[model samples]
Target: MPTDIAFLAIAEAQQLYHWLPAALELARRPDVRVSILSPSDQILALVESYDPTGSLRRVRLRRPPSRPDSLFRQPSRLATLLLNYPTIARFPTLVTTEISSAWLRRVPGFRSRLILIKHGAGDREGGYKKRHRDFDLTLVAGEKDRRRMIDRGLCTAETVAVGGYPKFDLKADRQRFFPDDKPVLLYNPHFDPALSSWINHGPAMLAALESLTDWNVIIAPHTKLAIKAPPIVSSAPHIRVDMGSRHSIDMSYTMSADVYLGDVSSQVYEFLIQPRPCIFLNLDHRDASGDAFAHWKLGQVIERADALPQALARANDLQPGFVAAQEAAMQQSIDLSPVPASQRQADLILNFAKKGV
Candidate 1:
């Protein structure tokens, strides 16, 4: 028998946690048969770790036997796209966390309805791609994205659902990186060259943290940065540096940190879940008036590493002035309720599947 709905888990592991909860929720209902499809053994293994009871059935897609790389293009992803066309054709409705999967809509005989559940709730312009319109339905973390989708004509009110962050539904072990209870600062930076503070201000940022005797620091950059860059190391007893590890992607650092410090990574929103002190870096000196950096208003915004001492001194005290705004922004950025986000997403997916579009 054909699967009623299949989740295409073809992206990086960081993105996997975002959509897995909804798939597991769908599997609980007897009327719906849900399966997870992927070409990556690593992704499949991670999926199994979450669905240990074998609730989310797995199907492995094919990969090219061998392919040469050139300066402009790597064929691995494109090859996977071509090789998996037949498998993608079998499902009635397909749900994925990746926007690139929309490329499959161009296939000659493809008939499955495409549904997208965005992985991140960041405010970067990259999140609003033209390709998003290709999907039949979209699920976003908050009303912030839903409004942008409608404003950009990427999706309509009916086609998009305000699904809260499904990744929040996932629970990971909390870890303590520091021996003492000094305030912990999580310094996470984005990988984007145009926006990242690490490219130009990283070493200086680390130096600023080392100068602080009153704080414990976790210098965890975005997971994508560790992909091509060398591992960042810190020898300071109070400072811990993680380039990319399971702890980085699993919310270990975000949950453990007391003060949030970063440039423009979306992880700031994740850190804001508890409404703690947040400090944003504007090292590149970009214009701050844009909506892309709206979260910056929730806390102090500094332009250089030299300002760290003064900013850290005031971050917590300033929270009362910003807490109300932070809470308001959280409501704008995520939809929360008595019903779990996973179930809400599953309800939408199942209803879409029932339509036989």
Candidate 2:
């Protein structure tokens, strides 16, 4: 019998780009039936757009009950997702990540082959470490990244390196950069306090950018950046703030930008893939410890908000060595060989299902 597979993502609809590449590839398999389990209407729409003929099945999760204290919201939502797994488990194979997958595996009926795909582009410290024994297979982005996962004992050496970021495969359009005449600056802040700019001196950083009227600023903050109302932000005319959008994962914004700025978000790795100048907010003020991709060098690590002007100057300066180093690290972080990454990932999932290995 042909293998049936399911793709699951708990991320919001606008944030679905991170998983699209893997989902798209799995959808193309002639021997594998693909279904996407996501809650966001936007993600459902995106899945349909990519598979107009209904090649991929989609299951939209019901919204979890809300509580008075927002912190309790996580456990509630997680419980809600866990309840949906038995229904999802009817498929013979499951490809998922984050807490949803972790919980789904606990269901006794979900004995089918499970492939856990890591989401971040580079190895970063302080992410959830799942025992490889729980997953039938692990999917990583590149060899170095795969090694990073192995070194942490997070997964067995069986993890395969699949060279694509599913979200990056979205069609790119230059029109998103308009008014296209000005140089675009992408401000992407990291989420964690241990390695992010917003946790320490976000206001000062925002103030620095407020003065820059001549440049075009596009703020693509990490999805978790603003948890509360008003989003703990100060706005300025020059900056176009994206809280989150239906078109979030397109990545054309990163490619269209002249310079990328932020702390330790994976957007840096994604932006560097294009060889653009970057300004790293050295807010962590220490070396990366746990994440394997720490060896990657960032261009112009600025230690303070006062250094914004200088960082911008350095980005505009276009240092050859800096650009080259970043490019090399990007290549090492994600394989950009001749093979189309999406197809490679699709093949891995399909083969795993066939062999049941």
lDDT of candidates 1 onward, in order: 0.84, 0.66
Residue 173 deviation, candidate 1, in Å? 4.9
Report the Cα lDDT for residue 207, model 2.
82
**Tens digits of lDDT, candidate 1, 1-357:** 434899987666788778999999999987778888877666777789888899888998885664332211123655677888888778889999888788888888888899999878888888888999999999999999999999999999899988888888884655779888898999998888788888777789878989987999998998777654567777889999887666888788999988999888889888877899999999888899988899999899999898999999988788899999999988998887778899999888888888884
Using TM-score as the measure, which candidate wins? 1
Q: Which stretches of candidate 2 lie over 4 Å from their true place?
A: 67-77, 131-133, 176-180, 228-235, 287-296
lDDT of candidate 2 over 84-190, digit per residue (tens): 75666677787775534666566666677778776667556644465554777777666666776677677767654555565556646544544546677888876
Give the 10-residue window scoring lowest on summed lDDT in candidate 2. Answer: 67-76
Q: Please estimate how well model 2 matches the true structure, expressed as its whole-model Cα lDDT.
A: 0.66
Clashing pairs in 1: none
